[model samples]
Target: MLAGSAIVFGGVFGFVAFKNHMIKQFFATMPKPVVAVTIAKAGLTEWRAVVPAVGTLQAVNGVDISGAMSGLVKSIAFESGQDVRKGHVLVQLDTDVEMGDLRSAQAELALARTSYDRSATLLRSNTVSVAALEKAEAELKVRQAKVAGLQAQIAKKTIAAPFDGRLGVRKVDLGQYVQPGQMVANLQDLSLMLCDFSVSQKDLGLLGIGQAVRMTTDAWPGVVFEGTVAAIEPLVDAKTGMVSVQARFPNADGNLRPGMFARIEIERPSGAPVVTVPASAVAYNLHGDAVFVVREDAGPDGKTVSKAERAVVQLGERKDGMVVIRSGISPGDVVVTSGQVKLEHGSLVSVAASDPLKTAAAGAVR
Candidate 1:
């Protein structure tokens, strides 16, 4: 009786296993769910290649205007923020003491000349000693030197512009006592602006003088300023490992100012064929930076179906919401721009009629 009962249980278990196998086979033959995704072809798209760097706008020539002589300010020769030429007087200090010294030196010089004439006449007649004539001649020289020294001192009291530029707000007022080398105002030659930034050592070789640079600033929204590379630092910073670069831009209207923050993009010449895709095509995760490429192949039933496959890419610079694909993907491969979250290695996908990647990237920063 025990053997017969064991046989019955074994048959029941086998029947159940066969039914489960048939059910799994039926589902395996069924079509997979299609995921709607936006796709873009990774192709040879020509874009203005650039190396991005952050920098500050500066004047080609700028300095803080200062006085050279210590004295009470007598007058101001220029208005604040006024344009001036080279040698234009910006400030004038009291020169009364210097002028008085100059007059005294002149009178003393005349006295010495007269004494020298009388002593020389006496010497010819042997009435005065030779030492007396030499003394008078030495006195004349001392007086002449004093006069010249006073004149130079008086000239320095009048501060003049070193170059053509606009003066900043006056830092000294009339009757205010200012010491030597004290700043009186600030001046800048804003006709041409210089933008200075740093670039990495790896990218330093790609830059050169006269390459076009485009810039924009938050201070002036929707406005673009252009320039050319003026200089590159010969040595890289040992600690930071960056090289300095300078660019110049014409500022005829004086729109650009020194110390303003600016974003810079230095143009790069075309070289090898590069593949690019929309920025949305890339997915960042723990595995690595990658993109999902669409593979169209025959399904089990001989029908065309798109499968999402992951491809690791080495990324280059980002420009205008487009990412440069350095490696791991071909030019003609189709990449999913959106709806990549639901994708797996073999996820069945369908291409959306309209590509939404461009719309999603309208205001995105590259």
Candidate 2:
């Protein structure tokens, strides 16, 4: 009985060992897939970097119209928001007082001239003493100077436009008293406009005078305005580490106004061709960036299967959700845009007909 029991126990142990060995061999002999892959072709590529900034629009020539002499406004020749030309009469102040003063000065000047002439004649004829003639001449000169001063004051009462421009809201009305230096209205030469903005010091190398620029303002959506760089500041701001720049734009229609905020963009030439891939395809690590490429090889059954292989690549600029690849990959190479996290080097894979990557799914594959 003891011999029979030992035989049965030995047979049971052998059966268990055999089953475990077969299971191990079966797993080992499983075939790795030969992945289907697309080949890359050489082509031209462009790389560009953009700098964005917010700025304000201004007129090339803007000024505030003011009174030069204190007086009541007699007549206003311009309406609010009206256009005027250089030397055009804008305001006529109450000239009654000024005119009265001018007339008095003219009469005094005539009297002085007559007295000086009589003194000269009498002195020449020996009828008047030299000291009396000298006194008369000095008094006559004083009266002439006073007349000239009054005439100048009269001219100051009339205000004229300094340049061709549009007028702002009127600050004073007809018959309103305005003091000297008081702002009567704001005027801006909108025939040409200027856009002022600042950029980082690092980007200064890319900028130059006369470079083309594009701009947009919230007030006019979907409208693009073009301009050219007019000037670059000689000095940079130390605190912000930025340099100021101004761009000029023709505004013959007078649509653009001073102090309107704008968004600016500058165009630059592109450099050498760069490899680009969808941004979603890249896997980032502390060491470097990497992507999975689908590799393929023929199997014993003469059919192809897919496998994933990790490739390290260098990155450049990013635009439109696509990143420029500097090295380690070429254009048209099949890359794993999705399912990267679950993949390892030389891992077997099954590619579904549907695009697993959100980027590729949005558009047709190139």
RMSD of each: 5.0, 6.2
lDDT of 1 by residue, 1-366 (tens): 899988999899989999999999989977678899988777766556778899998898999988778999999889989999999988889999899989999999899989999999999999999999999899988988988899999999999999999999989999999998899999999999999999899888789889888899998888889899999989889999999999999999999999999999877777765678888899987788999999988888798888999998888878778888889898777889889999988899988853655534322222
**Residue clash pairs of candidate 1:** none
* Candidate 1 global Cα RMSD: 5.0
Q: Give candidate 1 misplaced runs (Cα > 4 Å).
A: 1-32, 47-49, 117-130, 209-212, 221-224, 297-303, 356-366
lDDT of 2 at 300: 64
Clashes of 2: 4
Model 2 CA RMSD to the hidden true structure, in angstroms: 6.2
CA lDDT, candidate 1, residue 57: 89
lDDT of candidate 2 over 128-218, digit per residue (tens): 9999888888988888888888878878888988899989898988888899999988999999999999999988998999998888899
Candidate lDDT (C-alpha), each: 0.87, 0.80
In model 2, state the lDDT of residue 326. Answer: 81
Top-TM-score candidate index = 1
In model 2, the worst 10-residue window by lDDT is 35-44
